[model samples]
Target: MLKIDDLIIDKEFEELLPVLTPEEFVRLEQSILKDGMLDPIKVWEEPGTGRNIIIDGHNRYRILKKNNISLNYWENYKFMYADELPTRDDVKRWMLEQQLGRRNLSEAEKYEMVQKFKSVFEQKAKKNQSLGGKGSTNLPKVDTRKEMAKATGVSEGTYRKMDVVMKSDNEDLKQKLREKKVSVDAAYKEVKSTDQKPITVKQQIDRLDKRINDIDKTIESLQVEKEEIIQRRTSIFYALDIKCPVKYRWDKKGYSNTFPCFWKCQIYIENEEYENIFGEYSVYYNEFPSDCDMEKIPETYRNDFRMIWKKAHDEIKALQDEVDKKSMENAKKQDEILKNAMKLIPTDEDKVILKQFYRVLANTYHPDNKKTGNAEMMKHLNDLKAVWGI
Candidate 1:
C-alpha cells in the first residue's frame, strides 16, 4: 500500500538510520532556516508492517525531530510509492555521483561510497542482465529519488511549496512551472505579478563580483595616497639640523700623528690704544676648494675666527642632511628603475651579483666607526666625508 502523508516512522526505524555529525546537523539546520527543504523525504509502506519507511532524508527527519517541529506541518506533504521511487542501489549510485561533483567530500569517503554504490549496482545489474534480456531489464532498478529531487533544483525545501504551485489548475501557470525549475517563490510571484519574468543566477553572481572589484579599487587608491603623504613628511629631514656625527675609516692602517692641515706663525704688536694679533697659514691636502689652514685666512677675518669656524660647521651639517635625504629619495626611485630594467636585462643573475658588489663597496665606505675593524685604519676618513654622496 504505497501512500503519501499517511505513514509514520517508528522506534525501530531509528536504529537503522544513517549517522550524522554535529557539524553536518548544524549546517542542515541553518539551510532549513534559510532555504527550507528542496527535496521531500522518500517514504514507502513497510511491506506488511504498515509503517512509513524512509528511503532517503533520514538526516532531515532526525533534524526535524531534534528541533521539535510539529508533525502537523507535514500533513499535506506529497509522497511517492516504491514503484514511483528509485531502488536502494540506484539511490546509492546517485549519492556517489553527487559526492563526486562536490569539492568538500573526502577522498576516502568518496572512494568508499563510490565502490559501495557501483559494486551493488553492478552485481544486481549483472544478475538481472543474465536472465532473459527483458526480465533483466525489468529487474528492480535502484532508487534515484534524491537525484530527481536535485534535478528539480528548487532552493532547498521549497520543493514542497513548488509542488503546490506546480499542481495548480491554471494552464499558463502549469506551463511556467514545467519550464526549467527556478526559485519556487519567484515562480509563484511571477504568475501573481503584472510582469511574469524571473531573474537568472548568473546575473546574481555577476552583481556580487562587480561589488567586490569596486571595493578593491577603493582600497588601492587610499593606500597610494597614504604612501604619498609619508614620502612628503620624510622630505622635511633635508632642511633639518639632524646630523648625528659619524666616524669612518680612511685607510686600512691608521691616522698619521699630523693633522691634515698646515700651521701659521703669529705676531702680536701693541702700541697704546692699538693692538693686533694675526697669523698666516698654508693650505694642505684637501678634496674641497676652501679647506686651507690659517696662512690663507685674510687679515680682515682675524678678529672673527671663532665665528668663521662655527658657520663652517653649520654649513657642513646642512650639506650632510641634504646628502642623506637625497640618498633616501634616490633609492626609492631606483628600486622601480631596477625592477623594470631586470625585465629587459638578459643576465639576471649577473645583475644580482653586481648589486651585491656595490652594496659591499657602500659598506666599506660607510661612515660608522664601529663598522670598521679598527680606529687606526680610519686616518683619512674625513677626506672621504666631503664627497660622501658621490
Candidate 2:
C-alpha cells in the first residue's frame, strides 16, 4: 500500500549509485513505457521513523513517477523491503557492497567503493570495541588491504597504487583513471616524479647571496648613469649663458612665502630690429610653470632648453625610483640570508671547518687586495661570522 510520495530518498545511499548517462536514462524510460512495472522498488523501513527509504531502483522509480503511474491502479506494482539492515551504517555497507558487486563498474569505481567499504568496516570495529558488547566477538579480525585487494580482483601492489591515485590532488589523473585512459602504474609514477625534493639551508643561503649581489650591481650602475645625466644638464645651462632660478616652493595659503631674489635673463625678438620682448623672467629647474609665454623667445633656443630640461628631470626621477626598488629587494634578501644562516648549529668539528672557510673568504675579498677585493663581500662574511658567534 506504499505511495510514490511516501518513499524517502537518502542522499548518502543515493550517492553510492553511479549517475546514469542521458542516453541510458532515456533508454530505460522507453523500456519501462513499452512494458509495465516489471521490477519492484527496493526500500528499507527506518526503525523509529517508520518511513520507507528507497535503497535501489531509483531510475525505475523516476520513470514510474514521471508517467504518473499510481501504485494502487497498477496490479503489478510492488515494493521489496530490506529488513536486515537495522542501522544507517549497515545500510551504507550494504549499498557499497552492492555497487562493488556489479560487473560493469570500472577499476576506478571499484577502487573507490573498496575504500568506502574499508572506512565502514573500521568504523564498525571501533564502535564494537567502544560498546564492549558480546557482538564484538563475532566481528572477525580482517587484514583490510589483502581482503579488499582479493575482492577487487587486483594484486596488492596495484591496489596500493590505486589508493595513491584516490588520495592525490590531481583531478585530471583521477579522471583519466576513471575513463581507463591511463593505467594505475603510469599515474602513480607521474605523481612521484613531479614531487619536489626539499631544499637544504646552505643552498638557500647561496641563492639569497647571489640575488643581493645582483641588486647591488644594478643600483651602482643606475647611480653612475644619474650622475652623467646631471652633468649633461648643467653643461647645457652654462653654454646658453642663462641664469636659472636657484630654488622653487609652493605655498598653500597664497604667495605669502618669499620667492628667492634671483637674477633673470631676457629674450630678444627679431623684427627689423632686436627688441626685448620677454623683459626678464626666472627659469626654475623643474618647476617652470606650463602657462609661461614661450613665443617671445627665439624658436631654436627655446625648443633646445625645454627638451633638455624635461629629459634630465624625467630621467633622474626614473633612476631614483629604480634605485629605491633595488634597495628594498636587497634588504629582503639580506634578511632571508641571515634567517637561513641562523638555522645552522655548528658542532665542534663544524666550527673548526667554518673558521678555515671564513679565513679563505676574508683573504679573497679583503678591501686592501685591489684585483679580487670586494668590500661588500667582505662585510657579508663578517656579518655571518658574528651571527654564528664564531
For model 1, residues 271-322, the per-residue Cα lDDT tens digits are 3443333332221222222434444434444334534444434444454566
How far residue 98's Cα lies from its native spot in candidate 1, in Å, is 5.6
Give the backbone clash total of model 1.
Answer: 13
Residue range with the least summed lDDT across 10 consecutive positions in model 2: 248-257
Candidates' C-alpha lDDT: 0.46, 0.65
All candidates: TM-score:
0.26, 0.44
Q: What is the C-alpha RMSD of each candidate to the true structure, in Å?
A: 36.7, 32.9
Q: Which ten residues in a row have the lowest lDDT in candidate 1?
A: 244-253
In model 2, the clashing pairs are none
- The sequence of per-residue lDDT tens digits that candidate 2 reaches over residues 1-390 is 778898788755675577899999999889878976676667778654476888877888888888997665234344434468866667767777677775577788788766645655666555666565655576565566777776677998999988887766567999999889999999999877644555578756775876686576556544643653554444344345443422212222332212222323233332333222333444333434244555533454575445544544454445456666777899999999998887776777887888999999998999988898999999999998986568
TM-score attained by model 2: 0.44
